[model samples]
Target: MDVRTAQKLVMENKHAKGFNVTDVPLEVCLLQGEIAEFFTAWRTSEGDAAEELADVALYVLGLAGILNIDLAEQMEQKISKNAARVYERGANGVMYKTTPEQTSAEH
Candidate 1:
């Protein structure tokens, strides 16, 4: 019931009232905090971990909506780009840049 209400709110607020790149960094930081809390709960077997994770996912979805990003489509684009790269798969079945330091050097 709570989840359904959240989903309803998400759908209702699908469109953004305005554009703002400044909000992205703040939202990302909050997302990181949510992730940490979620993992902490999960590792300790605190039953609310799943709900925390769901809340974070919903927040990210809202961020994507505000950016007009279409999260699902953008994720597909990411997959396509990743598949074209030559990196080996990690335990998460996704590959990351070889080295964070060297990768940042290139950028």
Candidate 2:
């Protein structure tokens, strides 16, 4: 379904398993670990990579749920904002999103 539903399920599972419900720091670390696991699985084998990726998404949704963030809404707004944005390579060789004021100043 949607991200909010998935988030609710993730938190429910975590609660059932007696995980750290309010520990944002620990959850952030665990989310990072899941990302590492997914990267390793992706590099080594494609079959297990999907499972690891699911773990990563699960942790992400769980964290969103814990923080009471409207991830789906935020993602939609961010995508819309990004769509109307301009990007340019900076001196550091990294693409940076320039604000409207910057775009005007550069003109």
Candidate 3:
């Protein structure tokens, strides 16, 4: 299913299950927790790491629905923005992101 469909289903499931459906802060915290779980599962080489990632995605959809956000659009915009980003290698050989405005300011 598409993100919008999944988002709608997530909210529907949340409401149907009597879960907190309107609490943005709580939703953000829950999403953060799910992310941590995903990271831990991956780090530990757990067989259910994909499941934990699914949990993260579910929470993302639910939270976006609650916030009335067009997640797909936002993702597309962000991806485009990232694609246009410029990076410079630092003294330590690590790359750091720098915007065009910042580069001009430094010059």
Candidate 1 lDDT, 1-107, residue by residue in tens: 44345544564554344423347787688779888989989999976998989968877776665566667766786787666566668999997666333255674
- Candidate 3 at 40: error in angstroms? 1.8
Per-residue lDDT of model 3, residues 1-107, tens digit only:
88778888899999999998889999999999999999999999975899999999999899888889989889897888789899999999999988763355664
Residue pairs in clash, model 3 = none
RMSD list, candidates in order: 7.9, 4.6, 4.1
The segments of candidate 2 whose C-alpha lies over 4 angstroms from its true place after superposition are: 89-94, 101-107
| Candidate 1 regions with alpha-carbon error over 4 angstroms | 1-26, 88-107
* Candidate 2 lDDT for residue 9: 91
Show the lowest summed lDDT stretch of 10 residues, model 3.
98-107
How well is each residue in 1-107 modelled by candidate 2, as lDDT tens digits?
A: 98888988999999999987899999999999999999988997855998999999999998898898988899897788788888999999999978663345664
| TM-score of every prediction relative to native | 0.55, 0.81, 0.83
Clashes of 2: 0
State the lDDT at 12 in candidate 2.
97
